[model samples]
Target: MEEGICYLTLNRPQRLNAMDPSLLEGLLEGLQGAAAEGARVVAIEGVGRAFSAGADLVEFYRA
Candidate 1:
């Protein structure tokens, strides 16, 4: 933890941090890691302007 805070950042700025299966899985993994590391607080942040546009519609369309 940095300065007593655990930060989880979304790295897909090009896609407005859209939620994909991999990203979602990574988030869960990060959260689990934070807990395992005894982090008191976990903060989720986005790299770019938008936090997220929501789930990626392209994946839905493909299926």
Candidate 2:
């Protein structure tokens, strides 16, 4: 968080930032934190080749 801007980074580069339960939870937490801190903007980004590869099929199957 900086200058009222909250940055939520998806750091699962190995899996192309797949949306797993943990990651989703983290994002939700980040959003809540940003709101609590009065952030005017929330910027979500990824840390690797792609922003997101969608859901994690392997993890989904394991569930």
Candidate 3:
């Protein structure tokens, strides 16, 4: 958090920042934290070639 701006980064570059349960949970937690901290802006970013692969197909298939 910097100057009321919250930065949420997806760190699963190995998996192209896939949207899995854990990632989703972390994002939700970050949002809540940002709100609690009175953040005026929330920025979501991914650390990889793709912002997101949409979803984890392998995990989805296993479920």
Measured by TM-score, the strongest candidate is: 2
lDDT winner between candidates 1 and 3: 3
Q: Model 2 over residues 1-63: C-alpha lDDT tens digits? A: 889999999999999999998998999999999999999999999998999999999988898
Candidate lDDT (C-alpha), each = 0.89, 0.95, 0.93
Model 1 alpha-carbon drift over 4 Å, by segment: none
Angstrom error of the Cα, residue 28, model 2: value is 0.7
Q: Give the TM-score of candidate 3.
A: 0.89
User: Any residue pairs clashing in model 1, and if so which?
Assistant: none
Q: 1 or 3: which has the higher TM-score?
A: 3
- Model 2 bad stretches (over 4 Å): none
Tens-digit lDDT string for candidate 1 (1-63): 886578999999999999988889999999999988888899999989999889988976776
Error of 3 at 44 (Å): 1.0
Top-lDDT structure, candidate number: 2
| Cα RMSD for candidates in order | 1.4, 0.9, 1.0
Sort the candidates on TM-score, descending order: 2, 3, 1
Query: Per-residue lDDT for 47 in model 3?
Result: 99
TM-score of model 2 relative to the true fold? 0.92
Cα deviation of 26, candidate 3, in Å: 0.6
The sequence of per-residue lDDT tens digits that candidate 3 reaches over residues 1-63 is 999999999999999999888898899999999999999999999998988988988877886
The weakest ten consecutive residues by lDDT in model 1 span 54-63
Error of 1 at 52 (Å): 1.0
- Name the runs in model 3 displaced over 4 angstroms: none
